[model samples]
Target: MARCGSKACWFGLGMALGAVVGGACAMLVRTATQERVLRQRDAPMVPSDATADQALTVDATDVVEYRGFVIHVFCHALGMGRFKALCDIWESGAVVLEGGGPPTTHVTAEESRSAAIAWARQWVQRNG
Candidate 1:
């Protein structure tokens, strides 16, 4: 039996206590990280034709030519419940107009894309 007053006995007790505390801390950290990952995984996801392994945030990016002006629109989910859209109008290889619509809690990226395109078309009609 180790004497309670011995340095070696106290050192061993300290080391054992440290190991137990360290192990408990590790378990807590691991559990917290797992819960965070699970929460993100369970969040609403953007549907796509692509495979699950190929996760894409930007669902639509397309270019359209109208009246010799090119309209470029890009759309993506802001938070899976909201969406954002940006647009550019180019003429003769120079960007003539650039803007973005306000983010909205829309369910689909297509809605944002169509709204951006409609805004661009209206601008072209008034200017062209």
Candidate 2:
């Protein structure tokens, strides 16, 4: 009976250790991937000299032509159920408006898009 008990204890201990090790490895990998992504995002973007039409073709999927300005909406993951929306408005191949929402817990991608479009429209009306 004692021998059986000892064997079960050893097995439980081994399983616990394995779980700990697996969790630590997963955390390390996630951290490394996040760092790499951050580095890539922070890299300097070369400004283009293209016309408005050319710029429209650059990012067709996320670009919106509003009042002769190109508005690009970028969604950034902030982890822990938070997200950020960045609105980059371009005119004549240069950034004319840069704005975004603060990290929020419940904002959806669609909401972010709407907010960006509203902001851009206001900016264009005021400055354009």
**Candidate with the greatest TM-score versus the true structure:** 1
Tens-place lDDT per residue, model 1, 4-116, is: 79888899999999999999999999999999888863354554643431322443377889999998887655453566667888899998987644444345667777887
Measured with C-alpha atoms, the lDDT of residue 47 in candidate 2 is 33
TM-score of model number 2 = 0.45
lDDT of 2 by residue, 1-128 (tens): 43436878989888999999999999999999999898863343333433422332334226688889888877543333334456778899998867543334234545655665677678777887
Candidate 2, which ten residues in sequence have the lowest lDDT sum?
52-61
Ten contiguous residues with the weakest lDDT in model 1: 51-60
Q: What is the C-alpha local distance difference test score of candidate 2?
A: 0.63
User: Residue pairs in steric clash, candidate 1?
Assistant: none
Judging by lDDT against the true structure, name the best candidate. Answer: 1
In candidate 2, list every pair of residues with a backbone clash: none
Question: What TM-score does structure 1 among the candidates reach?
Answer: 0.50
